[model samples]
Target: MKQSTDLPGLIPVFPLPGALLLPRSRLPLHIFEPRYLAMLEDCLKTPHRLIGMVQPNAVPGRDESGLHKIGCAGRVTQFSETEDGRYMITLSGISRFRVQSEVDGFTAYRRCEVSWDGFDQDRAPISDTDCAFDRKVFMRLLDRYFASQDLSADWQTLEDAEDELLINSLSMLLDFSPEDKQALLEAPSLGTRRETLVTLIEYAMRGGEGDVMQ
Candidate 1:
């Protein structure tokens, strides 16, 4: 088990809008960009194998920092390279960090110094049983949300998923805007994320357009 202190303070960041990687969740990524490919190669050489997944700030004309303040660090768990040199990898979320500042370096991709305070719980995986999720009610809400979006999901798989897994995966896979997804990623806890998830669904069902009310 990696201790919190073992977490790296500096990590290469992948600033992809609309992408959310919460602690204990898995995100599959296709790495085709030259910078990200270099980042991936560098990560494989490091012992931590961590990559920070952050979103571009949502506000228009706000390019002060370009990225949101918070992001989740993911450990590269699965990786493979294709014949065309593209890399396929899966990142397992480790913890959420607040960006301290961008690090200027020779690397092509962005790197940041991140502070991992107040996210100690992320270091330890929560047992699926600890999640106080009411699957039945949430499933009904999800059904309506999915139907309204004209999207289909494998019912059996969703039924079999662990509580945290279901919630986090939905948060990442849903077609919500980058801003909405960032909200889900920044949620303080599993239960809170679940609440935020439900609220977003209800808002969408009601035809609430951009910038969902918090």
Candidate 2:
């Protein structure tokens, strides 16, 4: 697949807590709200069907209260419209971006001016050989974490996945809190992310009482 690094200055954003989209990963979304439905329509008409997946600040209030500074840009790779005017879409992760400013837009959905310079590496693939990640340790921690959460998965698939895919997929699928997900999304490198994931798993196993996962 071609990497999507040519991001626009302003892009529509979906602020969902505890949801994550990482470079080279895929995020499946169901657009039921009217504003998000409209966002989906507008994205389909564009040459680059892109959307920014961000996390809303933990503060309580309206949905648009606040958002984290960092997020991942994803391309709408699969889409379907339901008779009820809802949309089901799958986004293929492109790159990570930092919000520079929030743009005033007429659309009910929000838009942000973003910068992708710091995450330029997200556009390129990193070989597992370049990192000193202990997959066995990660998997062992994951096993205990899953048991505590009462979740199960195909172990074989996870064992065979590439390092990047394995780490990112776990980051997205795990039932971590919003803050934990954001930390994974903001980790500086794949190796760092792997370390973060292991730490998060251990924390969860200890019943959420430990040092910060970062």
Candidate 3:
């Protein structure tokens, strides 16, 4: 966990599509590639242990359009090494940042200068009372969507999740494309993200291809 004032101006970035990490959520990643494994080794030497998880932008004409402009930074929270030399780690989402510029570096992975502007609300505390939703309606739609993808969830657990947790978890777990996932990631707030999620689910049901809305 990093203090707001202590957030780094630059951090190593992991450019993977369909891997979204929202603030306060956890994303587990398998580090096997030589570059990312090296990235983990370097990150472990730093106290903050922060990594920027950004998705490659499929859209064109943006400066350095290889990656999205916005992404969330996460702190290494759990880690273990396998006998096969693979590293498994979990990242706890810290904050969202805008890419100011990509740093030219000798390291195997990419790094970026980021600005933590307009996302101060990510660090705010979330309470159970803040997580209200129309589950009856959502669950019904989810049931149909899940069946189409041959998936299922512990409805009881989902029903018990905090509003932020529910939305963020589903956003990360759903099998939407990079474009759809980016929409959820760039949502201005929780309420707006929820609306986007519902709209995506509705879109998927209407023939947009995607897996379960996990």
lDDT of 1 by residue, 1-214 (tens): 3476788889999999888898888999999999999999999999989999999874567564588899999999999999999999999998889999999999999999989988877877553333578899999999998899899999999999988888889989988888889888888888888888898899999999997935
Q: Which numbered prediction scores highest in lDDT against the true structure?
A: 1
Candidate 3: tens digits of C-alpha lDDT, residues 1-214? 3346779898999999899999999999999999999999999899899999999865556545488899999999999999999999999998999999999989989999999878878866652223446767877888898887789799899889878888899999988888788888998888788888998888887886664333
For every model shown, what is its TM-score relative to the native structure?
A: 0.93, 0.90, 0.90
Model 3 score (lDDT)? 0.86
Residue 120, candidate 1: C-alpha displacement in angstroms: 1.0
Which parts of model 1 have CA positions greater than 4 angstroms off? 58-65, 128-132
Comparing 2 with 3 on lDDT, the higher-scoring candidate is 3
Q: What is the model-wide C-alpha lDDT for candidate 2?
A: 0.85
Ranking by TM-score: 1, 2, 3
lDDT of each: 0.88, 0.85, 0.86
> On a 0 to 1 TM-score scale, where does candidate 3 land against the true structure?
0.90
Lowest-sum lDDT 10-residue window in model 1 = 123-132
Task: Name the lDDT value of residue 6 in candidate 3.
Answer: 79
